[model samples]
Target: MPTRKIRRTQLLALAVAALTVPATAALAAPVPADAAAAPTAPLAAPATTASTTTAPATAVAASPTGFLNLPTSLLPTDRAPHEISFQYRNDSAGDQSIAPQVLIESPVGGPFLVPTAVSLQVETSDGSWLPLPLGIETGTLYTNLIPAKLVLHSHHTLTEHYRLTVLSPSLGTVAPRIAFYG
Candidate 1:
């Protein structure tokens, strides 16, 4: 009799386990075709004009003189003695005159030769600065010629510094240091 009870209990447990699996599977089954094909509601459009109106205007600043606006790596390296020149213009709407100057220094702690043929012109007005015609040689391997001058107005005085180095056996480098005064 005990064996019969044990067998009955085993059969009941197996039946219950089988029934639970199918019930769980039914819950996980895919939705009917009618529900799967239903359309989703569209998302609301973002507000545009209000956001733009609240944003602040961007400000642009002018670049200082003598500083290379371009990356140093972008400068040419062609194994030649090069001449670097400096010029400034006063684009201010007001009538203001500025005196600009250029100076050159050698890293070797000696006076670098200036190109005798090159004529530097410095001019200033109530509005802008201009450079006179000058000659600059390009392409050669040497280090004697660099710039050393204080190009400024008669009443205004300032000093600037520059450095030169050999970029390649055939290419050279010219860097400018500039200063300004009223």
Candidate 2:
């Protein structure tokens, strides 16, 4: 019941640390075209030309919606008989981006799901849909209670989270409750 720190960057780091993405894959969000021209800017690509397979980073957001309003409860879990509810929230704002996170609780040694993938929708207030940069955070948890692979076997309660994000505030209100995997 202690208050958990909600620093999205650190929290996202924790989430990223848990994931198992191959080291060779590109993990950096694309640099904006304007920023790419500046040699002093970090992530300033040597070349702005995107590969045929990839869209330019600027193209990722069209007509550029000003910015997102922070912290919306997009998904609600049915905790049922359990006392704690699973909750999802947008943890990013302004130039900072952290994938939205879902806080989870499962009984130790019990069969449970750690989501491998999930899906969501985003739409404008006017009802037009927008493309979402979607990803499911996956990683291992390391500690005494959690083993090397992050599997649970102890008697203590486990509360952890993973990252998921919807790009636009236009995120739709109607969707099935988010589900998980083992």
> Which numbered prediction scores highest in lDDT against the true structure?
1
Candidate 1 lDDT over 75-171, as tens digits, reads: 2334343344443322222222222222222224423333342223222222222223222222211211111112222223232212223333222
Q: Of the candidates shown, which would achieve the greatest TM-score relative to the real structure? A: 1
Clashes of each: 9, 5
Q: Please report, in order, the local distance difference test score of every candidate based on alpha carbons.
A: 0.25, 0.25
Error of 1 at 148 (Å): 14
**Per-candidate RMSD, Å:** 37.9, 19.0
lDDT of 2: 0.25
Model 2 over residues 61-150: C-alpha lDDT tens digits? 222111111232433343222121233232212121112222221223433323322222233334333222233222211111101112
Prediction 1 TM-score vs. true: 0.21
